[model samples]
Target: MSGVVLNDVIKKYGETQVIHGIDLQIENGEFCVFVGPSGCGKSTLLRMVAGLEETTDGAIRIGQRDVTRMDPAERGVAMVFQTYALYPHMTVEENMGFGLKMNGHAKREIQTKVAEASRILQLDDYLKRKPAALSGGQRQRVSIGRAIVRGPEVFLFDEPLSNLDAELRVEMRVEIARLHKDIGATMIYVTHDQVEAMTLADKIVVLRAGRIEQVGAPMDLYRDPDNQFVAGFIGSPSMNFVRGTVTDGGQVDVPGIGTVPAAGLDAGREVVVGMRPEHITIDPAGDTHRVDLSESLGGVSYVHLLGGNDKIVVEERGDYRSKEGDTVAIRPDPAYLYFFDAASGQRLR
Candidate 1:
């Protein structure tokens, strides 16, 4: 119903600070996702928003009210966690209505809310089944249905699909995306999986070492990352980094990938060149690199090659016939090349 805002939020346990000062705003009906590697504090930040974890410093406002110190029940946000946390003995209908029942809502009101949530989640046929009778995805949907019954101001998902199998993860991603479209509710999701973040988020917050790294729409982050950390982390197969030297003639010299004019950098400076796998083309007629491995997945193939001491991955669509142990040459798109400061790991602009 309303937006959420964090003002210079900080979190610490004892003397160890896990979440540094974080300032973020989630617009009404926006799907914001917090993503990063393990121990990066993405979950900690989401829990802070849910009131499940305390904000050590700064303010958290949900709509117009400051909810930094509010109890989880008073925050008007429903959180679906990594674990299902369902009652084994309760039927799906009962489970969906349990929260309202515990709050002393009338039976009719609970049933009405539960029925609406059931219809939204397509759980009508399984309402009479207990947790023991439902499949993994169904149980997870019931878990989400429980949250939907609360009619909260915001929805928080803490890697809710982490427990599902590969196929179910994809299926639930569609379901969750559709749920957001159907409800138009503000949702904050946390995940270590960038694919989920890329496919689901209206905006993504990338975090590392208790601090916010970058925040933007998925494609924006992928196409124009602020630093090498982001450029490498946001894409699948990761970006390739190779040692390069800015030559006296204002050209960047890279082994195996050839030379490109430097982007206003001083001569004799060292830099790191980044190339995305999809932007690289393998030359079967030339031999400058050796194919370390090759994997074909239907129409797309990932060819891993060893260029000097650097490892490069080349993504080829349709029919790519590069095999392991072949001596091949690779070329990166000049327009897609990214240069970063060798010392600081920041983009060279």
Candidate 2:
């Protein structure tokens, strides 16, 4: 019953609206991630849920209680920010218990809560250590432990890993995922990195330009995207697109490559054909493709090709590395092909 529900929620600054009408539901104990590029209103929407931003229209319900106008502390949620925001003057234990002390909690009660949080985060050994004595990952874990001690109904994270180095970011990602599994609390995380969203979230909310583009399970959105934008945004290296025109025989003819069978589309219509890099293979017998560059990553390689006027990327494994300026024919798997309208970018089928 502690699930979150947004009924046509909206936000505006002055005369300009940032968040469009958005309706969403997040179940209790679910880890949902909001992911999109910069200036996409993902953070804005998250702030509204945190009660840090006012709703220009509609209502926000948390655990069946209306909290649209509630104070941040009254919303039954704890937020972790990109910055650790720890107290340098205090030890980890003191910093974790400071909030409860200020709230008039008894000394023994505060100590008990801090001890439990420290144990859960494996910071028991560092309880007496100051912020300066801890590493970046350890400090971030302390920040999370602070939230855990509060025992909020919902947990909100806003780009919490952005401040860490690449290696620490990966480590923190695993830590946070494991924490979610242990706590089983309703959590909402926001990040611009789709890879984090894919790996950490039970459900993902993809946003763009102040509007939600799509929402679904990670693999569901990856395997069956609703539009070109979602398909292009969800995957690493992105999906390749080439302009084409539909033919009379239910096929789409790319200007540089041959025709591809795409049933269920009208003839003579302008469209864009999409394919993933993994679905493309080099055809040694064909002569219309040229390898522009090859990126070797040990077990896998990505070969960038120039076919006619289009640039396509193909993934190769083992001994299929093609050098720059090498002539190669690249073919896409028709079974995995995607088609979209030229004007609207909507999926054709």
Candidate 3:
């Protein structure tokens, strides 16, 4: 296994440039995830590292060797795409070993590697079954097994579980994480799913508009986001933003909600107050807002409230339930509040 390094990488298509200058380093054996909204260049960046897409400028290095100009086969990386891409006529065992066979390995060598991969992926019983006989998860495991057989230095996954059902996606996520731990291989996974990135990555790279927004551990990005985009994108329920203004005593006054501390700001400066639903405390006794909707999901309930033109969701657990049209008040935890520049969406310290 080897590390990957990108120095000022850029990608362009004819006259239109898509990926801007990107500098990144993936340590050997690190599991890095590239994540963002759709068409944000996450897949394109992964392809650049895999030698599938042409790099418009800058250099790509794998281990100690420069691989920017290297062929896809010579880059020593294995890519598992969203589609299974397995041969229909071949059995699972044949499919897993086909790459080795094509590479001119002896039959015994292919069988040995295939057996090892099957053991890792728990495909011993399904080895004789064809693609038609296997489940979607099993076929993907076989696809992954083929990559393991090649012994690539870096493993690239392009939304490999997108086709699976929710349960299967979760199951495969555990399996993939375990595979990385057991093999200690360097891996780069691309996905639009922030949940997957949070659960699987040792390092998460957040990208937007052909550039990196932030890079850190999943929880680091969640807790200390540098901007409004990172804060809203990293969390599952997304952060809520409300208009606020700095007051005479350095406090921010939220129109519908009460005043909170801003400490140091010009008297009339505009700021966006951010609050997470989970951190808000709902006071049913106080009539500041009205419940617009309530979605009960077993142990947790999301209550949407409306006050004038402002709308916010509050997560509740325990005995209290806020039905539609019920009067309520919400107090966001002062320590948990984040303030951002209204004009630029930049986090304000």
TM-scores, one per candidate: 0.98, 0.97, 0.98
Give candidate 2's error at residue 308 in angstroms: 2.8
Residue-level lDDT for 200 in candidate 3: 98
RMSD (Å) per prediction: 0.9, 1.2, 1.0
**Clashing pairs in model 2?**
none
Q: In candidate 2, what are the lDDT values of residues 243-280, reduced to their tens digit?
A: 99999999999976789998889999999999999998
Q: Per-residue lDDT of 294-333 in model 3, one digit per residue for the tens?
A: 9999899999999956789899999878999999988999
> Residues 227-261, candidate 1, lDDT per residue (tens digit)?
99999889898999998999988889998878977
Against the correct fold, how does model 2 do in TM-score? 0.97
Candidate 2: what lDDT?
0.91
Candidate with the larger TM-score of 2 and 3: 3
**Model 1 bad stretches (over 4 Å):** none
How high a TM-score does candidate 1 get? 0.98
Off by over 4 Å in 2: none
Q: After superposition, how far is residue 284 of candidate 1 from its true place, in Å?
A: 0.4
Arranged by lDDT, best first: 3, 1, 2
